[model samples]
Target: MSFATPSLIDAARSVLIVVDIQERLCPVMTDPRGVLFNGARLVRGARRLGVPVVVTEQYPKGLGPTMHDILSELGDGASSAVIEKTHFSAAAEPLVRQHLESLGRRQAVICGIEAHVCVTQTAIDLRAAGWEVFVVSDACSSRRPESLTAALTRFPAAGVVPVITEMVLFEWLADKNNDGFKDIMSLVR
Candidate 1:
């Protein structure tokens, strides 16, 4: 469990992971509204910057599909690269690895529900599988603050980088003079 990355997150080598932001789970979360809003921001920004995004639903039959609000905002830009899994770790599903491989990305920016469970496990597995994993703290939540805190605290030892939404957005942009800066700035603000 090493927590060292040779360089910063490069968009060309990065993919965004939206995990289990389904209907039932978000509303019951300790910070559902924030999670959805921030998650949506990450998705939108990633799309604008040509970053690949892989969304996941943890058993939609019981939890229902992803929030309609996000889909509506995402509109036609919604990713077809979605994974429906029974496994806590999205990496447990072969498609996820294939999806990331197809994009040729080496880093994953993760956000979504159950910070202490699915998100945590996926980050760990992704790390073990040789992917640089970054978990967006503000864009993730659990039913309890303690649980979320525990996961964030333990992430570093698992070789997962725990970061805030703005940190990811800024790191992705990398330059205020870049063309996408204004758009990403508006989205985050």
Candidate 2:
């Protein structure tokens, strides 16, 4: 098993992926409030840095669309793309890969639901496809905390770095001298 060392500062070349946080899933996820808030903050921060954000709905027919709060935060922004997927691994979806390639983003910080299922598969597939994948553990949840725990345990060897939301944000900003630093710091706090 190979492990990946993620450089949090390389966020300029990274995208933010929110996976399968659909309406039905979110309500049952362990710690839904925290996950939703963190995902939103991460998306907002990604936008502030001009990083692209990609979201996937895991079969909207059954799960319903991505949660309204998350959808609102993305807000039809050009940098944000929503892909509807039937596959567990979003990387396997053509448009998801196409959008990543189009942005020239080779690294991503991934957050969302069912950490042991869709998130895990997407992380592995994304890495196999030659992208550096960082799974933001704090911003991700499953219906059971144990599932999230299992993913955090196993994903490193598959080349996904399990990280916290604030770590990614600060590393991306690098220093407080920049204008966006204060705004990001506020969000982190």
Q: What are the candidates' C-alpha RMSDs? A: 1.6, 1.4
Alpha-carbon local distance difference test for all models:
0.86, 0.87
Candidate 1 structure quality by residue, lDDT tens digits, 44-107? 8888787878889999999999997566555565453677899998988887767777877789
* Predicted model with the maximum TM-score: 2
Model 2 C-alpha lDDT per residue in residues 1-189, reported as the tens digit of each score: 454566564657989999988898999998899889999989988888888999998889999999877888887789999999888988888888888789987897899998999999999998987788889998999999899999999986777889898988887787879679888988987
The clash tally of candidate 2 reads 0
Off by over 4 Å in 1: 1-3, 78-80
Worst-scoring 10-residue span by lDDT in model 2: 1-10
Alpha-carbon runs more than 4 Å astray in model 2: 1-4
